[model samples]
Target chain A: MSSNSSFPKNEISIIRGKCLVLPGNDIDTDRIIPARFLKCVSFTNLGGQVFADDRSELKGAHPFDQKQNYGASILVVNDNFGCGSSREHAPQALMRWGIRALIGQSFAEIFYSNCLSLGIPCATGSEHLIKDLQKTIEADKSQVWELNLKHENIKSSENTFNLTLETGPLKMLLTGKWDATSQLISQKKNIEKTKKSIPYLSNFDITN
Target chain B: MSKGTLYDKVWDIHRVADLPGGSAQLFIGLHLIHEVTSPQAFAALEEKNLPVICPERTVATVDHIVPTISQKRPFNDPLAEEMLSTLETNCAKHKIKLFGIGSGSQGIVHVIAPELGLTQPGMTIACGDSHTSTHGAFGAIAFGIGTSQVRDVLASQSLAMNKLKVRRIWFDGQLKSGVYAKDLILHVIRSLGVKGGVGYAYEFAGPAIKKLSMEERMTICNMAIEGGARCGYINPDQTTYNYIQGLPHAPNFEDWTKAINWWQTLASDTSAIFDDEVTFDASQIAPTVTWGITPAQGIGINECIPTSESLETNERLLAEEAFSYMDLKPGKLISGIPVDVCFIGSCTNGRLSDLRAAAAVAQGRHVANGIKAFVVPGSERVARAAEKEGIDRIFLEAGFEWREPGCSMCLAMNPDKLIGRQISASSSNRNFKGRQGSAHGRTLLMSPAMVAAAAIEGKVTDVRKMLGSIK
Candidate 1:
């Protein structure tokens, strides 16, 4: 609910459309994309392998197997999602799978930031609320949860939850002003300010 | 007389300037790099036509993509080979020391740094890997960086960053028999929830931490990221000094005195302030494993998986998914969940001590039939050390494949994998769906000893049964 109109508005970015919610918290990066696939620098082919080693033994119908969910957009996850490893590939894979946004009780700090940097919107809510939304989706596979990024809210049936974002990060996402290097680039002027404030840093020979 | 906490002291000493926003531009004292994440950062440097500014302050290693089966040039995977080559070339060109495959010190970057004494107290360390916090066992401040940030470090030898508020996690009491560092951390993660450490660095202190060996301390710190903290560290103490005393990169006698003094100043003052504080009783922890697919979903081996009715609405559905994926019953005890494989290697628990712990459990008992158990040393040095101690023979004799050094089944690199929804008891961190290289594969994270016990039993079981008098 900021005055600035920076993020893409109104369009619902669905992540994983797969409706596949792994139970529990601390779902780590290694489980998202086994280290085998990490050798490739490009994220293009990683989506196909997302949970590759994990899905093969399913007895019958599983979420990833549904052709319709193959292109599902929203990723509804459990509490404390994306734990373990700073591997950005975890988010990259989820994104490539067409995940536009994730609604979870919470997210791993680095993974959440990585998602934001890649333009994937992540929203957090109470564990009880997120669980309700996840259950609603599970009960009806076709059910869709609506997220209003501009309003910083999400709705599943009659239940609604607010999303939390720290001030500076919210501004960047809302204004579409996020360029990974842009923050540092803009800080060039501040680097000079820093030097003047902490003169001792100037004497530390960085060239060594 | 205000005594600053370790976090406050470190923050104050390292603080360069607070940014206009809430972040800090704290300086980095040492940087470590690995083949996987550094290649692109090095490429970025090439694009900028820049030379590494402080090669002496940086160390590099090959770990992630190295094959645990063979120690040869040019890996079978073309992509893995290229990444290895890129790191070698980048380090050679930059004059940054790299521990290549088969190098005496070559191992997981985190393990190699501490083993070589490259990580020290009162320094801020950065790496492209999250486990870089492992160096914090030496009382240094360490953080993981992204590819762009890796470039920032290589080009300028500094990172533009925010200062983190520190949370002092004071653990009291002594660990009961069979409880390891892995269990202690898992317990902490469960209590705090995985996101509890967000926006903070965790300072692990108190008598329990002070009593643990340096390697055990590393295991605890290595998983700080898993708990949502950017980094976790322990203050330098007698255990720390003793561990580094004769190591390769540690200071000499003349410098040792000065180094210890500086290290002493790095500890949190008794009156130091913290953004938050939490405490745990070491006696409350137990050998734990994930009942569901996530680390935080874990309970002690003796516990049962929670029913949907026991979980929050959002968590219930995930529990349902876990039930189907893990093929487990909600009310059943997690103690005997069948395991198809066992893996004991990764940055999290792949050091020599980890191997020794697992070896002790596997020494006399053979791995269960149909269970593919393996032991992958985190580095060549660890492998060599294990060999010198005949730990390899112990593992091999017990039916666990003693493989070459590298992250093996831990993340399913190099073909050491789980197949057809196989469930594994893993010492390496994490237990996410398909984290072991198969779509339906499941992982149960546990202590190395517990992993060994499960490997032999072919099911989740308390390691205490196998421990039998070993404390």
Candidate 2:
């Protein structure tokens, strides 16, 4: 019952919120945030536009358009969510739309990395567990679910389900190193050394 | 756990340091940026007060949002104009090279880099766009990073990342005539589900791959992300060397020999172990097209869409969703599906070779009445070279509009977009719902030649029949 705490490390370790289940496999980024809306120089107003096309097509019947689903922070989805384009806007739009974490059967590689960059945790579970969670969330949208990174399990009032997260990303998320700019810069010496060692950099002056 | 593969070799060479988390920091050798994704990253760098660590290694281009109809300054779409100008200001302030609009060298980031010889073997490339994997055709490891990683590259010239295993997709036989590289890749994505390449880098090898032209190889690697792999590569060979030998930014004559020597060693060893391997008979693949939204929802031209009973349980949901969204039904053949639009350009199949192949189909045929058709070259160099060969004249005479390049209608960031419920035959990579702009628009993914064939017929026609006639 007490497993959903992130006090010691305290950096994007645990994310708690009402969960919204988007039931579909291979839901792509284009559907999440269409390219037509990507003309802006900033992502500031993307929240209102998240899933605009989908919501419009559904004509207020979409889960996103449902008043009950509003204010949900955890997005529960089926396999391969965020499966197209490397647009961070997809996740940025979702984040702005109030999603802070996601639990899915699987996710696309670039999308997972993008979510990590924004300090949003994407946890994976087995097919059975993910399906069960989606069903559970849809049944009770009012209840809150907690995603505890340190514990590596999602907690609901009724049950605790383990989630799969690679050690590299899990540790980074827990330690607040998911925003990797500073960590990458800390390896400046190593970067310079590797740069010096690259044969092309030294062998030619083919600067574009 | 893959060993001695090109992926392993590149990772070993670029490995900088292992960080606190189990991730390693690898320096990016080449960083490509564009108008749509660079502004926020530049702003982040400014907020952090960090300069571009290696300005010379980064190159910028204005695409995605540029109007193919007319790339005039002060674009009609103010948001787009602001985005492009922001990239220009940022590149100038950061001392980065930008191939702005009308810069003969300016084009899609992926196309321009390869044409200018910035993409080479044994290098690491990073771009904010997913198709950055296109550069992997040169035997380099390329990553499709988000904007924040773009900021990291701008600030430190490096990224903290977990490594990926290598999957060797070996094609045993040659592709059948008219069954192009696009077909082969679409077949690969269909054989292995779109999520199949997750957590792995794909090494495209074997005899069939070895015989492809450099441009053809780029087409395959360009869509690697569509198959879910962030990186895909082929070992550098004479074909690769020939392509890079004398390009504008390629190694000078003095260093060419040395560069070749190093590149040759980057290929996997004879006994190289792979995390996983799959063999496909290229000759067995047919002209492929996606009937559903996802790239993996593809079948041979002669094949019917699978019924729910035929799909994997996990795949059924998306299939149902696709069937509804695309207004397609199960058990219907993908061929002869009427299309409203035919677009023949994108990072996936927008190179000169792609244009030439599509032109051959359009050479003696006019597009079907009432079908809107157009051709957009991949880059400025491609457009000029194609025009020099009078490819543009062939398209224009065939009743297809010949337009400028810039990812037009592929992602539909500009005015070139599908209207409501318009179905498109596209050479671009994705076919997601609303991908081509209109909420109800549908797309069929195929080779550029097939796109040309579809335009001529106003339906999805098999290119093999048209090619057979040409001979």
Candidate 3:
């Protein structure tokens, strides 16, 4: 493994942690971070409040509230997780809560993109494999899980599941091309040229 | 050259470049920013020492956190004031146009954009708000992006996006009276599960859609995101052209005809292919209401709450969760469910037409004694128009408090909210748990007219039953 000090700032090709299995499908953005908490000026300190209402309602029974899952960095969920609202806070709250990667049956498109933008890799596996992996993690909470993005495999001490990521986002994660802002800045000259060609944009002046 | 669908034409015209991956960089034609999602994005741009590349393409408005009761300087909620001031500072720094409170144009971003004619056929609109899809009513490709994506748009006037498959949702028959556009969309979302449109852009079509007013079309498109679509659009026609002809920001007379011709070409060719299609009979739709948390978990007002057996195996768990959260009993009739609050406003149903519909219902009837009712306009212009039409007086006479324009009681960012476990008949979008401020507060989503009916009856009453009296 590469030294921690040498970790790339823009891409994550691998992640290792004890997996925390959240047993539910369509675990929407509102549950990930309640609308109440979204009023904050910044995303900072949102880690502590991720799943705040759900955890409270469950009375410490939520997987994330359990002591064994405290530092778990990989989150495994059922199909269609983060399915409602285009709230980026959902992924931001998860990332801040120490989740470095997500493996599930599937994820909502916007949520997947938000996670990818943050250099967090979200992968998928068949329902059977995902459920089996969740069971393995639950039976022994201490088992370390490793997600190898380059090889498309997720492994635990007793099991290995084949994982798949969309080719577009996978390439973006591997090559650090997910940072669209930087890419946009680099192509400024071309954008300026485009702006000049569009009559509506070229003729737009604040004075007018 | 291949004849393209509306989505393809818009996508191709806006595409800046193909990125390293299978994503395309799309130049945004308009960027609408609001108080809630823009602060962090502006801060990020500041950190990167980046200026807004094309400030003219971006427009700023304060909506989410602004209090509807009193929108004076130094807002009662310090956080709300700070958010507004931050937007003011950012817009001033970047030379971006801002419709701050008291500006005649100030309103919900989605509502004001169309009213100002900033949303047009064949344009690509991006906003840091979920209801950005509301603009797609004008035949534009609109996206609701996250704050980071907002920063990307502000810094480069473009966004990197993977193309979406197109799905044509065609309505086969005319809507029955009392079945509003809100009901039509609610029916669509319920029939097609919440996750059905995950990777698609929906094209709303058929004779029923073409017959809708621009405002009604906007109401339908506003909740396209609720059905999990990336965006939704309607092909421009005479109705679209007529609506944009006189708007201040629309193309002048010299370019108007040319613009209309180009917009007409953006519609799907007769032989255009679609990845998927769904057809709905609009005649069957009634005034709809969400009994559970999700927008999809809705039924006709007269229908009973869905039984577990009626739900798919995977949806059962969420249904149970919603049942518990909403304090609703499975298989119980959705009608006569007592409502403690009646809220008539949101980006989804706070436009002028929505206000007129609600006012029509409230003309002579008084709100029930125990029900707390309020009517909020979507924009300052809407508020003014309502006042001019005596619609505000009708609401006031009906005992519904008429308030200033903003996103009030929608997400409950401001002072207006449901007190503890109060069930609300809300004209807003989204019925997610605690979405209306109180952790236990419950919202039942419906049309503005339905909400007005609920206020008068003090329960879930059919808008159709009250329509005869109003007429």
Candidate 4:
């Protein structure tokens, strides 16, 4: 979304929402938000263009375009989601489109970090478990899914799937340290100290 | 402590602190910024009232939105003009050096850095662009960060990042003529798959890599991000030093010896251990081209498009999708595919040497009728060098548009784009769907010489065969 919205900055221990399953692997950033839509000065209104080409091509056949999945807050996808281009628009578009959490077999390193910075936890599960969850969610669009980060598990009516997140991101999401700028600012003194030690930095005239 | 890899040594030296989590606060030695990703970052800084902690450490340029054909002031596209003006304003406000239009040093962020000697060995470079790994050619630990991370770097001159596992990608022997660094990286990606390098920093080493020129090494590391590595680098050596010796921003003559001595120690120790090791024979690689959406879905120029049966179960669906999207038949030979456009530019292959290689192929030949071909230099300096060497005249005589420096058609942020379903043989990186500005445009990624050959034939012809014909 706009990122300036009053979304909670921390306390992402648990989340409950409808899951929209998008079956595909290596769904790159280009597909998440096509390059054409990346020309805007700001990321606002990107939700409408999320999967713009795919949705137009599929003509409402894509899960995201379907009426039943209109307000889905969680997305379940196959392996290696968000694989190309380091466009932050991918996660921004998804977040604007109402996705608050993502569960997939894997995610591109940069994409995962971008999502985490927005307080969106990208958890991973085994293929079978993810597929089963996707199928179950597809069968009933209204089914509620519970993602418990504290316990590292996702539960639907019929099954509970184990999800895993790296400890670094997990802590960042939990404590709102996801905003590295804040932490960096708090450590300004230390950073300055280190900056002075770098020979190249000393070459620059740093007034701050 | 035991010996460490180049990545380890660089990481250890730049690491400012180990954060509460397992991540490290890494001091960024050079921060390169372009028009597209920095506007939001500067906006964030403005919103927070944070002055750029170290403006001298950061350099700005306008690339993605600058039109290669007509880069005159007040671009036809209002948005492009706005982006450029915004960058100029931000850089002026923060006192960051910007290589704007007409600045001889201005070019794609990746291309200008090394040539200016702003990119150095053992440095930690960060840019708000994914291809920032291109600087790793100098043995630097480089990373591509998002706009927010760009903001983080601007505010603190550091980035909080998780340490990546080191992977040694050893290649032996010598690359055959006509096989370039693009092919080698394509071969590596094809073998490892796109996601194989996730959570790792690839250290490209061995006899083959040692033989490549600095620009060629940059080409190899440029696409490392395409294979899912956060970054990729080669060990700096005498070649690296020679490239840096007298450049504008390089160490002065008095400091040169001391700088060389320090850089020599930045390479990985012979006994350094890695988290993973993979090897390939240079002889095994050939002139390669990507037929599918991802860089990993490539085949040798002489090879055929793979059928679903030939792919792993997980790869079949995407392959099938690619077949349909590209309007290509499975098992069809990649060489004979007709091309409508041939582009030689972008940070991946728009260097001076790339232009020279393409110019050699286009010396007496002309672009095929009805096929559009163009060459955009990686930077203004590259363009000037090509012009001085008469490479631009050769390309122009060959009926290719010799254009200004900018990231043209690479992501197609400007007006240069493939209209309709025209298939392109492009030297630029990424063959993603609609990556060349047309929703249905198809891109076949290849080397500049191969693109030159493809332009002449209006088909995906092998450069080696064309070389013989030219001789």
Q: Which candidate has the highest DockQ of all?
A: 2
Worst 10 residues of 4 chain B by lDDT: B462-471
Estimate, for each residue in A1-208, the C-alpha lDDT of model 1 and write its tens digit.
0111123333233222334455556566766667777887555577776655455444335465565465566777776677777777777677666667787877877777667656677777777777776776677666556666667776656556677655555555566543334344445554444433321232222211
Interface DockQ of each model: 0.26, 0.60, 0.44, 0.48
Residues B152-222, model 3: lDDT tens digits: 99999999898899999999889988889999999999999778888899899998998999999999889
Residue B128 miss distance in model 3 (angstroms): 0.7
TM-score of chain B of 1: 0.96
lDDT of 2 by residue, B1-471 (tens): 889998888888888999898888888999999998888999998888999999999999987988898888899998888888898899889899999878898888899999999999989999999999999999999979889899999999988888899999999999988899999999999999898899889899999999999999999999889999999999999999999988999998989988888888889999999999999999899999999999999999989989888998877877888898888889988888999999999888889999999999999899999999999998898999999999999999999998887999999999999999999999999999999989899999999999999999999998889989323
Candidate 1: segments with Cα more than 4 A from true spot? A1-34, A44-79, A93-105, A116-164, A171-208, B1-3, B310-314
Docking class of 3: acceptable
What DockQ would you assign to candidate 1? Answer: 0.26
What is the TM-score of each predicted model, taking all chains together?
0.83, 0.97, 0.96, 0.97
> What is the full ranking by lDDT, best candidate first?
2, 4, 3, 1
lDDT, candidate 4, A81-174, per-residue tens: 9987888888989998888899999999999988877889999998998898888888889988899888899888877888898898888777
Judge candidate 3 at residue B68 and give its lDDT. 89
Interface RMSD against the true structure, candidate 2:
3.0
True contacts kept of 1: 0.36
List the TM-score for candidate 4's chain B.
0.98
Tens digit per residue, CA lDDT, model 4, B244-324: 988999977766776777787889999899999999999888899999999999999889999999999988999999999
